[model samples]
Target: MFWFFCAALVIIVGLAILTPVWRTRGDNGAETAAGFDLQVYRDQLREVERDLTRGVISAEEAERLRREIGRKVLEADRRAGEESPAARRNSAGWIGAVLALALLLGGAVWLYEREGVPGMPDLPLAERIAAAEAAYDSRPSQTEAEAAAPVPDRGEIDADYAALIEELRAAVAKTPDDPQGLALLSMHETRLGNLEAAITAQRHLIEVKGPDATAYDHLMLVSQLIEAAGGLITPEAEDELARALQLEPQSAQGRYMLGLLQAQNGRPDRAFPIWRDLLEEGPADAPWIAPIRAAIPDLAWLAGQPDYTPPKTAMPALPGPDADAVAAAEGMSEEEREQMISGMVQQLESRLATEGGSPEEWARLISALVVQGRADHAGEIWGEAQTRFAAQPEALEVVRKAATEAGLAE
Candidate 1:
């Protein structure tokens, strides 16, 4: 379906570009050809005659100019008579036009084949969710030995967190099987880097969630297992990953972890397609996209294919000075740079005070102050932006994010 759209687009562009060439097949550059210069010379002679009639030029001067123009016109007529072979010129034009059209269409297809997934199938959101189910059904099921395998050790932890862990344990013990409590425990353990505990909590969460449990739930369990084993994808974890796909094949974390597991296990061929499809359908600005994009080139090479160039992502920029400004500052002496930076910010502030600016400009001012490590100044700008853009949520968010980055948020 994607290929069809691309082909149709190419056809439309090709027709639009080539249509004029096809229509003007008889244009042999004749209007500007040497043969047509005679008309130009005659026109010049008429202009001189008009000048004489208007009494702009004396009769003697006009006659001399007319004689010279007439000579050039006659010479032009002779060359045009020699050059006139309409059929030959028309044939040449036709040949050139045909070649141009062929190159245009052929080049498009050739480039797409070389640098693009020319005929790659499109996997819509609905289709990918269904595909996950099919993929899970096709994979080998886990063995009893794998299911019975013990959870990996989580190793040492800090005293403060360990004390909190005891409290979490007590709560879970009292409830026995509360899904919400277990879910919180799982996430908290993951945050504390206690993968073993996270895995245990997630399993209990799944038991309580039951059929209500989603593919994301199973996938998260697989994630905890892998992290606990120092990134080693155990058979039990793989089984959980399969269960995830069985529910939602397009689950971002599930597909990413599965592909990562395959790559780790030295099966880049399997990993490449999964990663490729994920990138195709994943949000350009999603947090997961950056790592996936960074890994694809290596994956392609491991698969013995040409290096892949993933599409650009929409990752947010750090809320501080832009690279160009930072680099320019780096080139200046410390004091000079400080003075210039201070002046630039001061100018922005003065303008905002004297002539109120937009929310975006306010956001920029706050970000600049943050980069300068002036939290107080950023906070001031944040307050002003809030008061100014209170009714506009989107505009307010821009300034609000800048303030938060500047450490001014309440």
Candidate 2:
């Protein structure tokens, strides 16, 4: 069908060009300017003779007119007898028209051959979506993916480290229900490139945690599962992600993993918006932010938004004492300065508790408490921030940093 339309267009253009050439050629034999001039001169000669017969002019005057008209008539006759330039131009036109048509058709064919798919069928939206679904359904299982994945090469370990790992494995085996041992075993196994072993240990850790398992615990299991499958979000990993979200409905990590699953399963239409929202609700330093920014432009193109541009992101300003407050503190005595600083901290905490605040404010408050030798209170504030920013991974990360600095988290 495409070829047919191309051929029809070529023919239409050829006709428009060739029709003028053919018409000009056919009119080449018709009366030309020289012929018409000769006829006018002959008519003028006849008029002069009639004027002589009617005595409108003297004989000498009439004779002069006859000679002038006769000379013009002879010149016109000579010119009319010669071949016209139109004949030569008509002949050249035919050659030019043929050459132009040939060039047009040849260029069209060459361009299409270079740039177009000759036999591919049209892919409309519905067909494309169906194809994506087919690919999603036919994806390999976790075991198959792991089997096909390339093995990582960890250079030989030191003898002491290798012996320690073996001893840890034996210890974990003896204490199968020990969450701490399982967690340590998982971490060490992951470090040693034993992804399968890491996944097994993490799974056992979650099982031992049981009803006490947090969303973070399940997410850790999911992370190991995905790594074991060589970054493919397998069915087992997806199940763990669902469980994590069930435990904490506002889990940012779980939502990010969910978006990743959708992306891997040929559903960028679903993934793009999830990642876009995460990008917009950001503190700019979340672990997921980098990957989302890297992948979103392509996802948006796939989602039929070829013009989408990611929003700019920057670190939020943390709330704290201003320059004026620092300057005023320089003149006060130590005791008085302490009182003023304590009052400011208390005021910030009160406003945050009463009206809520940004993750930066929460983090600032946590840091302030820690500076005042209030580690226990910092831990409590960190817990509250985790719950408050649970749905926003970027925001949660900001507070998590302060909590980690206060020695409240690893």
Candidate 3:
């Protein structure tokens, strides 16, 4: 039906263009203004001759009129001779009409062929939603996805490190319920590209934590599951994501994984808003921010907003000691390095206290305090961060991770 309408429109336009050329074809040899003027002048000269014969006008008058008429005739004849022949004019007109029509039709066809899906039928909103649902229901399982995924290359490890990993694995296998051992195993396995093993260890960690497992714990399991399946958010990962969000409704990573699951299951309409909100509520260096920024434009298009422009948000400057300070300290004597680091940490602490800072800065401050053997001060800062970022769950999560590392949180 669409093709029929296009063809009809082309025919109508073509006819409008060619009609004028065809109608004017018959008029090509018709008498022109110059020819008509020449004929009238000759008639007037004949009348003058009649007047002279009848003695109504003298020979002088008659000859004067003849001379004037003859001059006018010469000018009219010159103009007529300069005009193009009717056949040549008609041929050129036909050629121009043909070219115009060809360009119009051919250009339309070429553009459509280049940018359009030629034989695809129009998919209504309802049908499209149904198709998406079908795809979501039929997506691959976790085991199937992992089986199909290519093995990742983890370059050669040091012999001592490999031996340490074997010992860790044996320790975890011997005491399967040990959470710390499982966490260590998971981390090292992931580093060595043993994703399945990493996932298994993480799952065991979560089981050991049981009711004590926080949203972050489930999110860890989700991450391992996703990585093991080569980035596919399989059913197992989705369930874990839902459980994480259920445990902590404000979990940033859980929300990110939910959006990812929606996107993978062909529901960009659902995914786009989640990601857009995450992007807007950002610290710029949040782990999910980069991926959200990269994916949202296409997600917006998929959600029927082709003209949507993402907000331009600049990344905030790092609030702690800069890289140059660290490099300078690297070449100093141990005591000098310690003094330099202490100075830098004091500077960071002053700036953060005076102007406030991003969650990342707070996290860095907490870690630095722990490293300086000021666990009491670090605990005080962590307590303050909880109050400061109480309303911002994602930011609080960032600070909480550092607190956990410093033995300040579970």
lDDT of 2 by residue, 284-318 (tens): 74546756877889999999889999998765565
* Local distance difference test, candidate 1: 0.70
Instruction: Please give the RMSD to the true structure for each candidate, in Å.
Output: 19.8, 10.8, 10.0
TM-score on alpha carbons, each prediction: 0.40, 0.57, 0.67
Over the stretch 190-239, how does candidate 1's per-residue lDDT look in tens digits?
Answer: 75555567778899999999999988788768766665554456678888
Candidate 1 vs candidate 3: which has greater lDDT?
Answer: 3
Pairs that collide, model 1: 132-249
Which order, best to worst by TM-score? 3, 2, 1
lDDT of 3: 0.80
Candidate that would win on lDDT:
3
lDDT of each: 0.70, 0.78, 0.80
In candidate 1, position 40 carries an lDDT of 79
Q: lDDT (0-100) at residue 23 of candidate 1?
A: 64
Considering lDDT, which of the candidate structures 1 and 2 is the better prediction for this target? 2
